[model samples]
Target: MLTDLHKQLLNDFQRDFPLVERPYLEIANRLGVSEDEVLSALAELRDNRLISRVGPVIPPNQIGASMLVAMAVPEPELQRIADIVSRFPEVNHNYEREHRFNLWFVAVASTTDHLARVLDSIERETGYLTQRLPLVNDFFIDLGFRLDLSHA
Candidate 1:
C-alpha cells in the first residue's frame, strides 16, 4: 500500500534530484528522515515494483546517445532473450509489449559508436535482429508523476 512518505518521495524527488556525492543523505536531511529510513523506503518501493528505478533522468542527447530498440523473439525464447538483454549495463528500461516486436528496451551509451556496440553485442548474444530507433526530435518528455497515496 502507498503511504504519505511514498507520495512525498514520488512528488518531491521527481525533479531537482540531488547530484551530490551522497544524494540519499541529502534527501534524508531534506525529508526530515534518517538516512537509513530513506534508503529502506526506496528499497521497499523498488522490491514491490512500485517504481521501476531511482536514478537520474538525464535529458536526451544531453550526455549520451540513446535509442529505442525492439526485437521480435519467439514465444519460447522470450524470457531467455529478455534476461540476456537485461543483463547489459547499458539497458535501462526493458519490457514486453503485445505486438509483433514484442521485446523493447532503451539503451544509452557515451557515444553513438558505443551505443551501436551495445546493440551489436545484444544481437550477437541473442541472435535476434534488433530494430534501432534513434530519436530525431523531442516531442514530449514527462518523467514525473504525482501519486496520491491518500486514496490508497
Candidate 2:
C-alpha cells in the first residue's frame, strides 16, 4: 500500500525530475521530508516492486544506437538464452512475449558498429538468430504511468 507521500512522489516527479547535484535533497525539500526519508521511501517502493527504476528515459538514437532484437528461442532454452542475453551491458530490457519471436530485448551501444557486434555476439553465444529492428522514427514515447494510490 502507498502513502500520500508515496503517491505524491510517483505522480509529481514522473516528469521534471530535479536536475540538481543533490536531486533527492531537492525532492525532499519539495515534499517537506528529509533527504534520507526520501531515499528510504524510494528504496522501499523499489523493494515492493511498486516501481521498476528511477532514472531518465533517454530518447532512442539520442545518446547511442539502439535496436529491438527478437529471437525465436525454443521453450526449453528460453530461460538459459534470456539469461545469456541479459548478461550483456548493452542489453537493457529483455522479456518473453507470446509470439514466434518469444524473446525480445532492447540493446543500446555507443555506435552502430558496437550494436552490431553485440547482436552478433548474442547470436554466436545463444546459437539463435536475432532480428534487429532499428528505430526509423518515433511516433509516441510514453514512459509515465498513473498510480492511483488514493485507494491505498
Residue 50 in candidate 1 has what lDDT? 78
Expressed as tens digits, the lDDT of each residue in 1-152 for candidate 1 is 77667777767888787879988889999988988988888888889887778987667778989999999999899999999999999999999999999999999999999999999999999999999988888865775776666776
Error of 1 at 91 (Å): 1.7
Q: List, residue by residue over 1-152, the lDDT tens digit for candidate 2.
A: 78777888788888778888999999999889999988988898888988777898778999989999999998999999999999999999999999989999999999999999999999999999999888898975675777767677
Q: Pick the candidate with the highest lDDT.
A: 2
**TM-score of candidate 2 versus the correct structure, residues matched by position:** 0.77
- Runs in model 2 deviating more than 4 A are 20-39, 47-49, 141-143
Q: Relative to the true structure, how large is the alpha-carbon lDDT of every model? A: 0.88, 0.90
TM-score of each: 0.66, 0.77
Question: Per-candidate RMSD vs. true structure?
Answer: 4.2, 2.8
Identify the leading candidate in terms of TM-score: 2
- In model 1, how large is the Cα lDDT of residue 134? 87
